[model samples]
Target: MANVYLKEAIRTMETSSGTAANYEYASTSCQGWRNTQEDVHLILPNFDSDTSLFAVFDGHNGIEVAAYVAKYLPEYIRQNRKYKRGRVSEGLKEAFCLLDGQLLLVDAVNELRAIRRQAHPELPEYKPGITSGCTAVVCLLKKDTFYCASIGDTRCVLCRNGKAFPLSIDNKPDDANECARIMKAGGEVVHGRINKLINVSRAFGDHMFKMVPNMSTIEQMIIPLPDVIIEPYIESTDSFMVLMCDGIWNSMDNSEVIDFVGSRIQKKMPLAKITEEVIKNVLPKEMPPSGIKGKDNMTICVIKFKGKRGGVGSTNMSAMPRTTVRGNNGPNKHH
Candidate 1:
């Protein structure tokens, strides 16, 4: 039975600045044999001064958690006191933890249910036992620096000088640290799943996995804490960054994606077009033994940086107007 809530969708957003660093980004979500489209994204060009934020959220069980993060993570980070004080790393960590905490609140859960009901009235009502969650990978470009934060399987990778450099690590249940933590918290890892249910050991809003008697938040079977990476962005050497869900990674490795995108960029293809091609490459042509073809919602975000240098100057200039294009929920192309 095909999931009625699942559909193929594409969204593109782009911005170019004559003064600061310019960026081009696009995202595509294909049901691709899945029952639901649980992937969501965020693209905020020149979010503040010289900073830009991009992220991919891959939801499991339900889309509410992913949608909530896509809607609020950036705002939470920007409003953080640490971010205002120029502490990007601290600010991001604080923001991720805070957002996870907020998801457990009664008001937050109610709001998510309301939004889901409004978006998909055909779906069943939200119940107390319903447990949903999402994985997040975020890239924040501030001045000449880049910050990457991730939890769960979604990943952020940088392509520099035609080579792939991972910005975030995949948090899986089989990892030694994750397994140790889960065991200590009275949770068992069975077949690479936390309690034989969730695969990723760190994510946002898996309330069931997070509920451990007398255990601290960090000691839960699955924690919302993210692994963050900070690096200097070299305009001359760095090419672009790829943020994607596990669906892409499950089919293609990091190097393969980088090479594919690099080859397309060499042909002078638009960033949005490159993203479309990537999605197509991962989408399965025929249904296989797994019952579904692709079996996952593939979402990709490509951020192509302008080769210009220099941070936002003293002149307070407004950002370029963002243009968004959405494609129909079918195998269609939109420029």
Candidate 2:
């Protein structure tokens, strides 16, 4: 039997705003066959009781970035001007981008590198922080609008009616467009890979692999955090949505998740139970062993909406259809 460790957060039907969360979040960790490479968090903002949601912060280069984001991002949103009481989407955009920028200030990285050098003067090849990279996918759903952003290979997907929409894109070096841009900037996408190691084209805290002072990080490049996908709501939409990391997707596609969830929904299964099934069923296919290196963690979150009405008898999936969005890794990418 496959073992799955899961953590999740679901917005209450009636939030402090006296409104429904209509939004939910989940984070999970699976050491699995591979060592634990994933760290995730679902954070709720204090400002908007009506906000009905939080975000998933997935970390790679250790849990530092993810931990950093989980600690400060929500607080940042609460103080930002754009994050007016109910402006969930706008607030999310500002918070996510702002957090991405904050990584450069991780002064400890250089210090850690210094310590490593001192410990192994002869083995100069040991670079402590360079090979570290992470992906992040953030989603915020308030009332009728859904906001999303992502970086790296992690993803965010939405399901409305029976159709599926991908809210986030994979930012890999092999991607022709990303490759072209990297090359144009005097940077090479070596080995048919963006950074010659990981596939993600943009990320946070991969100090060594970053393009340097001239190229700048996603924050400095003025690259918006992953684009936001917003959809309205009508009557025909499902009442629940799922958010998960790549571990789940490695085995299950949108249709598969939808089918499983749909059947469970008909059976009136609890949201938590449904999410557990996903983790139980979908673990990575070829993970490494105890001492071997591979992906770190797996996180999942599921949101279930209630009583969505679009005036009179409207069935617009675009308007709304219980959507499932997922985010993974650490920093929000600009792909």
Candidate 3:
């Protein structure tokens, strides 16, 4: 098994609306089959006890872009005015777009430009920009809502009562509708990947190679725009979630993870240890995927709503009964 390092972990108590909103969260990053790449995540305690969390920052070129998002994106929300009102989701969307625009605002594309500029101002590559890029799958949980948004393949899955539900859809080059839109706008979808380069058509970086016509700026060059999904809680404490990067999904499917996690929770196992075991069990013993070419980075964060006061019988996670739902459960494997 690979020796994984979970960069950060925390569980904080929350209070909202003059009342206590109990919450517990834990996260870790693993070097999934790749040595150079590192995954990053954070649970930002922001805005009146709401939880803002993200995972699967798949970095390309260098880890700078992903690292930047992990460290600073949450700060934007805390500082942005719009987020203070009821428009937190919209604020986050604009923040992402603005971040890309700000990247292209500078004059250089090297990762170490800032450091170099400070150290030796005469260096040409010391300009104030970098070409690095990263994808983000973020979730903001407030009250009983799960507000989710994504830029790439890193996904969010919600599970309740032993069933799998998708919380976000991956944005890929081959998405037929997206492909048609790109082609109509004179963009090419080559070899199942947009412009025959990045597998994910929309992401936070790669301003150097995006759509043309100077099309809607470099950011929109890869844009159908990011997606935002908000859903009511499933209401069953037995329900849990798996937020992961592509590596875990590549080797296993929704059913596999849901079954594993569900079975463990049913056996009264802690989500924290179960998450760690999932990574340890999946990683091979002899040849860890790390350092191997073509192996993507891996990371996973799971959240389970625990009952209040006493235990399971108190406030289990049962979806406030729904009507006209598509799957057996709400949003199962569809997000």
Maximum-lDDT candidate: 1
**By TM-score: ranked, best first:** 1, 3, 2
What lDDT is reached at residue 239 by model 3? 67
lDDT of 1 at 48: 90
Please identify model 2 stretches exceeding 4 Å from their true place.
1-28, 43-47, 85-94, 106-131, 190-192, 219-224, 284-296, 308-335
| Stretches of candidate 3 exceeding 4 Å from the true structure | 1-21, 45-47, 107-131, 184-186, 211-214, 217-219, 286-294, 309-335
What TM-score does each of the candidates earn?
0.84, 0.70, 0.73
lDDT of 3 by residue, 1-335 (tens): 33332233121211111122444444545664454453566555344454545455766555656666665667665566666777766666666666655555444234335533443343343223234467778777666666677777778888856788777778777887667655765667887766676677666666654435434542243652457776656454336777877767776677888888778878977666777666665665445335432145556777766534223343433534422211111111110
Give per-residue lDDT, candidate 2, residue 240.
52
TM-score for candidate 1, please give it: 0.84
lDDT of each: 0.75, 0.52, 0.58
- Candidate number that wins on lDDT, 1 or 3: 1
* Higher-scoring candidate on lDDT, 2 or 3: 3
